[model samples]
Target: MPRSRMLEYDGAAWHEDCFLCSGCRKPIGSEAFVPDNRRFYCLACYEQQVAPRCSHCRKALTKGGLTYRGEVWHRDCFLCCGCGSALAGQTFTSQGERPYCVRCFSSLYAKKCAACNTPITGFGDGKYVSFEERQWHQPCFKCSRCSVSLIGSGFFPDRDQILCADCNSDD
Candidate 1:
């Protein structure tokens, strides 16, 4: 017959009266357990009910969760706040405690065109050109003085207007 092994702690044998799981209110028996603050949790109870939840999906994370600004997220639940796309291993931005993909961030938050006074939402395949922080649609990018398209040629910003190098020299 095998002799029962005494579980010792500090200088005394560990008492069995304190071996209950806080979550399930069940005796821990000989099962594995962990300490949470001043309470003890059985392995199953901790994994099922005591773990932190993902902020995006609201599901409990068994092993680990990504923590940001006091919020938690699962690896697959960390999505762009604007378009709901995955942001892992991709360039992203944050606003008001929400993460966003680069395109969604630029489209939803970037400044408007100085000339047209419309939002430069660079969504989908749309493109934008900037001169001195002023943004314009590719087709709308024209010389302010001559109203000529400056798709490829160089242009300069004079105060609130963009002028071709030729127009700037004429001024």
Candidate 2:
């Protein structure tokens, strides 16, 4: 065959017409192509055959997507397991393989604060106090009689009430 126009790719020289898409079997003719294991493919063919699929929607991911626990997901398909809300760019947590928004995760899984009866998230600077198998937000861990903070002070635990030394002596 006489070589009029040729292309050199991956150390092989071929006539321009012979360099074709592996999937569509059409002439590549210098349009953008992807080479996978010595096989050349056009963008459309590569997307269909080689691109990773979203774990939730099972669709090829041609644009931005996320990988969690070795599973792929489109941004829109990454939803909270507990509330069915979009989780992209938001604070989220996972229990096993399912993802949850922060609000839902806290409501469903966080330990209940003994004093205020709200979820103790244990996130950020919001520290907690634990005593007698019960937990409370740091601010809520106060003396039952004086309403004073018991964070660093010695206290007495009588039934459900936590009394500071002064309050305990007065009682």
Query: Candidate 1 at residue 21, lDDT?
Result: 87
Tell me each candidate's RMSD, in Å, in order: 6.8, 2.7
TM-score to native of every candidate shown: 0.56, 0.82
lDDT of 1: 0.77
Clashing pairs in 2: none
**Best of the candidates, TM-score:** 2
Model 1 misplaced stretches (Cα beyond 4 Å): 1-4, 8-18, 112-170
For model 2, give the RMSD to the true fold: 2.7
Output the worst ten-in-a-row residue range by lDDT, candidate 1: 1-10
Backbone collision count in every prediction? 0, 0
Candidate number of the best lDDT: 2
lDDT, residue 75, model 2: 95
Per-residue lDDT for 1-171 in model 1, tens only? 135444443355544655578998887767788777767788888877788888887877866557777887887888998888988777676878888888788778867776777666565446878766677888788999888988899888778888998899997
lDDT of 2 by residue, 1-171 (tens): 576588998789988888899999999988999888889999999889988899999998877999888988999999999989999998788877788988898898988888888888866646999887888899999988889999998989989889999999997
Candidate 1 has a TM-score of 0.56
Residue 112 shift from truth in candidate 1, angstroms: 7.1
Model 1 clash pairs? none
